[model samples]
Target: MNKTINDPNSPHSIAAEFGVLGSMLIEEEIAGEVIQLLNKSCFLVPANQVIFEVMTHLYDNNKPLDVIVLQEELRSRGLLDQIGGSEYLFSLVEGVPSAGNVEHYAHVVRDKSILRQLMAAADEIGTLTRSGNMDTEELLDRAEQLIYEVTQKKAVNEPEHIYNLLLNIFADIENSNHSPGLSSGFPDLDNLLSGLKGSTLNILAARPSMGKTSFALNIADNVGVRQSEGVLIFSIEMSKDQLARNMVCARARISPHKLSYGVDEKEYKILTTDASVFAQAPIFIDDTPAISIREIQAKARRFKTKNDIKLIIIDYLQLIEGPKEKKENRQQEISFISRKLKEVARELDIPIIALSQLNRSVDARDDHRPRMSDLRESGALEQDADSILFLYRDEYYNKETTEPGISEVIVAKNRTGPTGSVKLRFIKEYMKFMGISYQKPT
Candidate 1:
């Protein structure tokens, strides 16, 4: 049903709708541009929407855009009489004189559609608020997601030529010399992986005592403290305080076990100094145990918008909960979690390093080294990840090993670069992983 011009209550632009439709009828090329700019929902009146839909069908089928073809298409679809027949179609072409301003009129239609969507969102939010059915955090996340959808509605991806793509690739190659993606803080790993390229999901898996968390924390510390970049860590298994303590001990080269008992004067002085530097670093930690994937998405987006965080680290993947409906099938749930994490990484255009638990089968091996198959629960972790790295330490499984304090980061899968291993010096007492060449000054 079409509203009269006198009805000013709802948002609508009948003149703009006529302008767009008339322009498309005047010039066939305008139809393509208008279709890309405005969908059927942008039409205020039901008749105009039906008209646009039929017009789109005709245009897509390579049929001429004219009164007779549109009428025939609508008639074939049994929508001609319902939308006021051939006379209404004639009026659309006669209403406007030119097709040059079709894009401008399409923007008007798009603006009106956005207004209606916002109004609908506001009403729904009001109802949700009045019901008080959801928790505060969850409700807030839902509301933000609704608004974010509206803001993102105008973003459309159109097909491009390879010539254009090559230009972008060349530009990136030139820019990479000065400004590469955020570095992992390890020169060897960064060299192999090209500095943890953005919009990529990198999985770091390890057995129980392989120091994966410590390795991740060391990267976080390096990025935050040394490089002065923003970092977000979803520490599911450990509290923020515990992570902070670990970072301090790692940076100061002090034993966490000794600090637990008591910090001596020298250790206390170094701790205070290191703590001050850490306090200024742009590292944010969320210790939400058993966090749902949706919660991670919401918080990650929020942090990305507010803090402009360059990196996101999930302490371990197994602790994350998938959709509640898939509780009975654990593998399906894990697959869902990993896929969503990858989507979140791409959506935010940042690297997400999600630590994962290796299967117990890793212990059955003589060497006890982790592998891609050992990514516990879901094989999707291997499929979805752009890079898969396994943490291996000889001292963890051997008592008197020659490679004590040395850990190997086996790059099992690297999508964009060569697959190889990088060695790092692991200081167990301080819970720190540093480059193999890192040495204390005499």
Candidate 2:
């Protein structure tokens, strides 16, 4: 058993006492006290391995972790000596029997309750640090650390891990697959975008009645029904029932005008049957109007956690509010919202399809085709978005023009690929946007 130093005046005795300094000294003596502590905790790795891992991670990330922080991290790991007072720790440092042998060490420190408590505290700190506002560089370092840790633990044969090495090649294949081969729902648009990637922000902009909502809904429905991925649509301007009605009409090939006016008995039956089919589709809608960015993020996270939502659609970015502030201008607020949405996309690792309204400047032009500058009130939308798509219908501007069936998806800004326009078929009554020439007028 380690000797308890009862003397108050003896520095050696005080050092030997099992108080804070003793625990801290013991931690320091171990060389990798933090790594040891973390290793012994739920991480379930060897001390040397943990040290090597964390050190390598920090080195790779170019982060310099201070000793005090490392000590705090160890204390968080429940590795500090809580058993015999400073005397016990002093004995360990002094090469006494209690500290010399692992069996003796275990026998001397019988109560591990402090260890559990320390572990819990450490876990709380880790969680807080991960979620709290840290500098971007610090956050990125931590993220890299986490990725390293997770990847290290992953099985060698894991498909995703193996594929990650060849990510660029896989991306190329994915892009190739997205070409306008056939009408799998807006093939031309897919050819331009290479399909919306996971963890990307795809902004769709258009004037009112130019099929912005319709086009977004069509894509969402296609993804949900064909790909069988969960999709969440937040319709800020329309009601859930109205959105559902539009989807049903589009899927059933019934005109929205006819559905809204009156349906014959046969048509009513067809609509009801089609609606039943759509009920099984993995598409969810929330028609909450004037939602804040925070609210959208919270809801998107909830949907992802609960239902594994793979895609999120926010109708009209202009309506999204920023943090409560009395003095911020509209442009600033919109900028904040746009950046937040992009952050949300990256954090959630899912595609966010946000519909936006173009400025009247486009309408004033003779061409009337929307441009990147037309993303109303927020230039950050152009900066933050991975892709920006403009929806322009020729018939909306030219009443006498014969090209009423064509819609152009202008890729005004693409962060990862070429920017160009792709044509699609816009069926207004059906509320559908399909790949160009996929459907013929009856």
Candidate 3:
């Protein structure tokens, strides 16, 4: 059992830190076990941290880790004198009674590291709140974001045995009546993707005017209204009112221009009836512009707790801001953003469908279909995503094409199943995509 301490210095466990280091030194083979629970940052004392770093370095480089090898490593780095030479290293070994409690000692070190992180976050929050730059909600949001980042950083990185995984696999096989994961509301597409799996990131890419937003909203409405599952959408490009209006158009079969103008009482009744359904739907939208990926994750977590959100959708990925200090360039920044989005999906245990814009090079090609390479600024988005989908409508490029009302959903990549395209009818007036249903022969 883990005990909580309230004193300012209670977070530090000096003896435990030494116990972990000494345990690793005694049985170098167990270095892998110690690394699993504790890293160099877990140690509170400066000298202990230095010693831990030397051991971690040796382990990572495939070098033998005994007191002799450790001493040479510290000497080569000129940290031997700084960390009190060979005598201090031997004292660490003498302190540990046995290697059996190394994991417990490492847990103590890790717990203290997390507590210190919490304290720092609280201090930062206090400083920011006193500055009076943000309102109450923004202040709370920022504080939660900081604290969540710390919690996410110390996630248990471990490998699970196959026996533990086989249990869930067998259960899923037995319960094969309903869809696995969440359904996408399309039979063929659902078969292609067994629905969107949890802890997966899916990319939905298209060029401008290809109805990416409309498609995303369609899926959101299906999950929120049809399945009664909570869904959260981050609309960085459009306002909440615009999204509501789109819902009305799609549900009521009314045009955008007609929505703005007051129609007759009969039309008004139709629009209101359609709008009422959306009002009751469990679809929440946030229209924060240029929002960072970290902010999106934080907001998603809050909604998941409060509203039981099961799915997250981000309309267009490039609009999201990346980390400020660590970004090397736009490509690297995008790489960082894409990587973080994938991490958010796994950490939150939900599927994230992030809309993306394909590079304009697709326009210059003879075949304007989007490929994996077309994922804008960062190829990392393509690499990180579990599935990649492309939306193509031939009518958009040539008004007089043979295929006028058809839209193709190209399943460019599927991590778990077969890849193929599903054809659907596109109604531009109402901004809706419908699956093609075949009639039985009379």
- C-alpha lDDT of residue 244 in model 1: 88
- Model 1 weakest lDDT span, ten residues long: 1-10
Model 1 CA deviation exceeding 4 Å by range: 1-143, 149-154, 440-442
Deviation (Å) of 102 in candidate 1? 18
Q: Which residue ranges in model 2 land beyond 4 Å of their true spot?
A: 1-184, 439-441
* Clashing pairs counted in every model: 0, 7, 0
Write one digit per residue (lDDT tens) for candidate 2, span 103-207: 323222222323333343445446657787775444444444334323233222223345546876778677774442112266656666767877788888999
Model 2: which residue pairs collide? 16-86, 16-87, 17-85, 17-86, 17-87, 18-85, 18-86
lDDT of 1 by residue, 6-63 (tens): 1356688999999998899989887888887888877778899899878887887789
Q: Tell me which of candidates 1 and 3 scores higher on TM-score.
A: 1
Score candidate 1 by lDDT: 0.85
Checking candidate 1 for backbone clashes, the offending pairs are: none
Q: Please give the RMSD to the true structure for each candidate, in Å.
A: 7.0, 12.2, 9.6
lDDT of 3: 0.83
* Model 3 RMSD in angstroms: 9.6
Question: lDDT of each model, Cα atoms only?
Answer: 0.85, 0.64, 0.83
Using alpha carbons, what is the TM-score of model 3? 0.67
